[model samples]
Target chain A: MNRILRLFAVTLIAVVLVEVGYAIPSFSRKYKTSCSTCHYAAPMLNGFGKAFKNNGYRYPAGTDPEMTKEEPVSLGSEGYKKVWPEAIWPSDIPGTSPLSIWGIGRINYAAMNDVKWEFEFPHEVEILYAGTIGENFSFFGELEFENEDNQNEIMYPFALQYDWSPGLHIRAGMVHADPTPNHLKLTRNHYNIASFRSRNRWRFRDEQIGLEVWGAGNGSGERGGYTYRAGVVNGQGINDMNKEKDIYGKVTYKIGGLGETGGTAGAESQTSEFFIDNSVTVGGFFYKGTASRAGFNDEDFTIFGGDVDYWYDRFIVNGALMFMNSGMPGIPERKSMVYYLQGNHVIYPWLIGLIRYEWEDADTDQDAVKPVNAFIPGVTVMARANVKLVLEFKMFLDDVNKKNDTFTLQMNFGL
Target chain B: MNRIKIVVSISLLFLLSQPLFAGDIKGKVKAKGVKHSGDAVVYIEKIDGKTFDVPKDHAKMDQKNLTFIPHVLPVLAGTTVDYLNSDEVLHNVFSPETCVDKFNLGTWPKGQIRSYTFKKSGCIPVMLCNVHPEMEAYVIVLETPYHGVTAKDGTYEIKDVLPGKYELKIWHEKLKGASVVVEVPEHGEVVVNFDIKR
Candidate 1:
């Protein structure tokens, strides 16, 4: 590879290294409950957590008033809703501070073929805020600080959401535009397809500034139900100079489990595994965007994917497949694909064991580039309700002789 | 002489069957470490040689406005209690206690009643509903009918206690109080106060 290309890859990898999963503990404070109430662990939501998200961060059964331990402060009066034209609509803000702080400390080991390997530590920090606004509105925001090249860089992503119904809602601002799960990934590195970037730098994990409409509902008694979301985003990510906008849509259906309702758990997360229900969720999504450049002709790319998640007893298995089609004006059009299969077992409520296999077939016709195959086996331990410890060993199947294996240990705490 | 002897025997039997010298046990209870001292149960332990008949009437606990109307209800052992749902929404009643064999009354609509009988004396069971977990109440089953719940001011009175030396106990869901031996005086009210702690 050329020096410039190698440098770009290294920079991107460094950026991804600091991208850790975020678990908001502010809700726990507001509810006066433990983090286990909504998370299998922080960031990896269980059935109830999914339902809670679908309801715009409110209780799904419309029992917020009864379940909320801490009452919210009202911004406007309910008496004003009847006089809309003459008065502002009523809503409530969190009674307590809605902010949560997360610190990530890590030790990384790489068996490098060229460069000296050293352990990395205390890589990133983030300030996160998520809470409900009144009855039908909610918001989530995060400010991320990372250490790279001996410098601290900051990035902020946030969104405001409004719930129209259980089957429909609207969200605006910087948001995750893909149908597949990325923001909530348990692994240090995002799924291959979600992190895949084209030559023009269009990565799915980049929080796109956009507007999305989504909805979900629990049918009945763990029968699960449906979830659908679609969005129109600035295809080039934040602060795009081009007029072209990207659009994507996704739909999912889950059966025989607490898809999103989590009625028994009552919109609460993993509070415990005793309530884990058997479920199968299937989904499909597509993203079409144009990558613009000043000197060269614009390139258009489209990615279509299908994903599935299965939960049975203490085991959860999930997989995704994505096919990408790209047209770069001076070169011949190319097609590529990335896919991964993963499984997780609840060895204990505090301990999780997982294995993932990923393969990337780039430029089908390019014989010079061999398919990249890898295996990532990891274990996550809950040091406490608010602390998590993860250890992952990743091995590249195609580069075993090149001594390119990597292992990472990360400690994340939120308060 | 034979007729007079029979009449006297019958009269003695009738007098023995009645509570000739009964008194009222009334007092103030100070439940420490809590907001309100109300709902604490004060009752007399079972008599050594006596057992009251199970009341034919049923005790009623009403669910209204997402709350249990009577937070604490004491009933004689083997008494049937009616769980009534008066809320607009459906309500369910279940207990995790083994006293009532973990009785579960499934969801019911407004104005419906589900009943369960507590047959074990000295069994205290918490009633809960899956529909509204916050709604909680306690059922205190006792062998004696002499029981009273303290008012908000912490005053309680168990009337018509037969003259005897008996154990008087206080039961609070979140607090514990020491039991005392009380000697009842015939035909009068006894003022016994108690202090409960966490």
Candidate 2:
């Protein structure tokens, strides 16, 4: 009890200090739009937001609105310094460089026998750079500082995208792999299944070095459109030790709602106009890879999943299901299934109520870990368009339960 | 002899009234694949060997509720437009089109107005706000004053056009536009319909 109280006091003070000291903005700065324009809440993408990301961070019209041209700075006859050498050297290509910063601070308490509590002043801090190199080429890069293994670690994701047309793009570099579309959700807490799978020893959805080709059917509407992505990545994570590469793919289609009906037929570019009513999207994904474990030898992991997101008026519903099959050199094959369902409704313009249920069966065999189920209920408060506060409670259901239920309070703000 | 005289008098009266009356172009625009076709501009293309004087009155576009009140505004070439900010927060108006010289009217507070003159005819400039990226509007400059904006039902009427052959054009922000040629009679109205699709 004393340890828990001491930890709580320290966390509270740290939260107060960070909340008053720092304010950093995100992609809202590059697009010069409000956070709500693409987010149902900060970090959580709506239909339009997904389309924007799939479009290589450019407007659906195939233009980079943030682009600005700058003259080179001369250093007296020696040479000139240009932001983008390609923009001035071989040929003149208009480009813009927009830099932004993002940071999050968290405090958590877990209800256990000892009542554990802890505070992380800043769970993560990231510096983001995104823009266009010319008319058809664009890029996004992130440098991050994170708390890992009780120490600070530096990480980054870099990718370059080439836009062949409004409906076609090829992106190459180290980037986040998408096993489920909710990778961009707004809340600091994650879906139970996503956390469970990501933390597994195999590391299925972690960022990896890869090349992806993606395209969208409609210009930028929230409905009646489709998007597809396929990529090859080093399955061993950022720094690879394996020689074989993994293949992954995802396809999503918007079934019905207000659709995009603009843009010229067969044209490479489009106008920057989109309409949004209620929308829904359904998608499926697959990943196949091989990893070598120290004791287990070489193991093959195959994963397949499906997801859906729907928005109607003030209500939003999302869910995902995944099945995994694993095989080791001399061990019996293991199969498992994980799934989560979530629903959110806007009780007020600034307040949203949410509920989610998740289940995970670690293995199908008799020796498999007892099936785990969780129920989570939360509320999100929007102090402003760029700021949000979340309170979540997690309850566990299991026969041989380890006391792991938790209560979390988080604050996310952008300038 | 009396019937011949009566016919001659009627013919002369008709000829005398022809120049006194001007023709009107009225039509309904059916916009396919868009949120109700409101704010689409229907105007006359430039007439050869003819130039129009800039209107003395300035056109107004208001920024209210974080949106441009009239999403689309059409004006004669060389006419001036006034941008009014009605929101409490600061707002900026600018254009990237070279036809308008890529003008950037810096940020201003509530109730403030900024003015810009568009001298280039046949130029359609998209208006944007740096402070609010989602806020967008269009300024369409035409060579003549004969134009009307469509309502929610896609109905529009361009009144008092001189009787002649002219090309009618449609300017929509989302969909591609098509032009049609029509001959206006000396008097009465011409009812023409257009169906525009993406």
Candidate 3:
């Protein structure tokens, strides 16, 4: 090899070493508690994870940095907080209720040969807050920017959260119907699954405009182990609504010893014990699109699915299967199903290994189609209660795919 | 006539000596640094080697408004705690571990009462409603009756503490362990303030 080629190879090797070396400890410290605590599995965000995201990823950072090397500085730290205390501030106003900041960053690198390498640097930073002036009403706004498309263009997840009663809450926001197990994009990065545009041009706004009603069961044995959420969305994505929009709804039911719903390990998460130790969710959505659109041809579409999640101590296994059939002709009258068999073991009190085999296939590959088979294996290390680092390896099996194998390294700390 | 007189005399002597040794050991147990509106039980245990007995009528736990009325209730071994759920919804009560009586009462609807008799008391625990995972109540069963729950302002005043060399102990739901200990002089009201550490 010539000198230039040798230099390129050396640089590539150095980057890979850093990435792999950093990833080793990253996997060892991501889920220090238990897998059942934060996720049903990969791409499956449990109740606690949702709260952490909604709160802009802020969580109580206990004392552990002194003992562990991967413990990232928290929002309370002098260096990080001083530079960005309002992690996702709107830049509109200052000095109002102490700005709250949320951020997620992804660093990816892949090497195919001695002279070729692919790299992507994308991150999302947001600032948001929710305030209430009176009973039954609250307003929330989240401004976010991603590096892939626009440099500083903002995407807002704005909405109003209403408390209808002790058992029910309603939210009307420009929000996605929460990317469940089926909706998640299979990718190496931990922050995001995948984008429809990455594979196809006319794919946007999987979010629909709608209202969601959610409730927790009262302690009665008959109703205790269930959490129900249902809503009617635009049947498209978010932010863009057309006249052909349809109503969508989803209901999730979890049955287990109390506190299991929150996916945490103490009284802070669950309030009761388990007489009926199990949890299951079944949901279906329908959309009526009569207007003419560019991507969608017909006037109607419907999606139906059911998710079953069970938690037995340190082991939690869950699977979700959804079917979407578009009324538009020449759309292959699609039936798409994505399912995974996941197992999580608490290696120790603070170390966790989560392995999952995922498969996503559709009836037709018309536009923006994803791979049919994906073998994903991931490990996370929860060095402490508040700090986590994750390392994931994703292998795609297909001839028309480049960058067939990918590795992801991520570190997250809240509060 | 002689046998009856002997039995009656023995019974009278046993009753006469009970008050002297036991001495109505009445005192209130209090916890500090809690702000939520709830109650907790305070308990006392006598160290007779490894054996102890909790008074039957001394321990009680209550649930109201879908929350444990007293968040903490300390009790002794072999004690019967009245687990009352006063909320409009039904409550199923059980503890997965650390107690012998792990029974679920199904659904006890509004304005109803159910009771559980704790036979083996080593730190008997109580949890509520498998459905309402946010509704939690704790009953810490010890081996003595020398415990009391804290008041609204985090102040606990244990009254009628028998004047003796007694080891005073305190506990809280969030507190890690016993707050502190003190010695009580005979017929003396000792003011012990516990600054519970998180």
The parts of candidate 2 lying over 4 Å away from their true place are A1-27, A63-97, A113-115, A181-183, A198-200, A219-223, A258-277, B1-198
- lDDT string for model 3 (A86-121, tens) is 563112111124234444455453445453333333
Q: Give the candidates in order of lDDT, highest first.
A: 1, 2, 3
| TM, every model | 0.76, 0.60, 0.53
Q: Write the per-residue lDDT of candidate 2 for residues B113-160, one digit (tens) a residue.
A: 888999888899999975456789999999998899999899999887
Clashing pairs in 1: A36-A271, A37-A269, A38-A269, A92-A134
Worst-scoring 10-residue span by lDDT in model 2 chain B: B84-93
Model 1, B111-168: lDDT tens digits are: 7687899999989999987544456999999999999999989999998899988899
**Regions more than 4 Å wrong, model 1:** A1-22, A113-122, A148-150, A182-184, A218-222, A259-275, A292-298, A400-402, B1-163, B169-177, B184-189, B196-198
Model 3 agreement with the true structure over B6-62: per-residue lDDT tens digits = 999999998885533332233343333556412534444554554544554745566
Top candidate, metric lDDT: 1
Better of 1 and 2 by DockQ: 1
Error of 3 at A254 (Å): 8.6
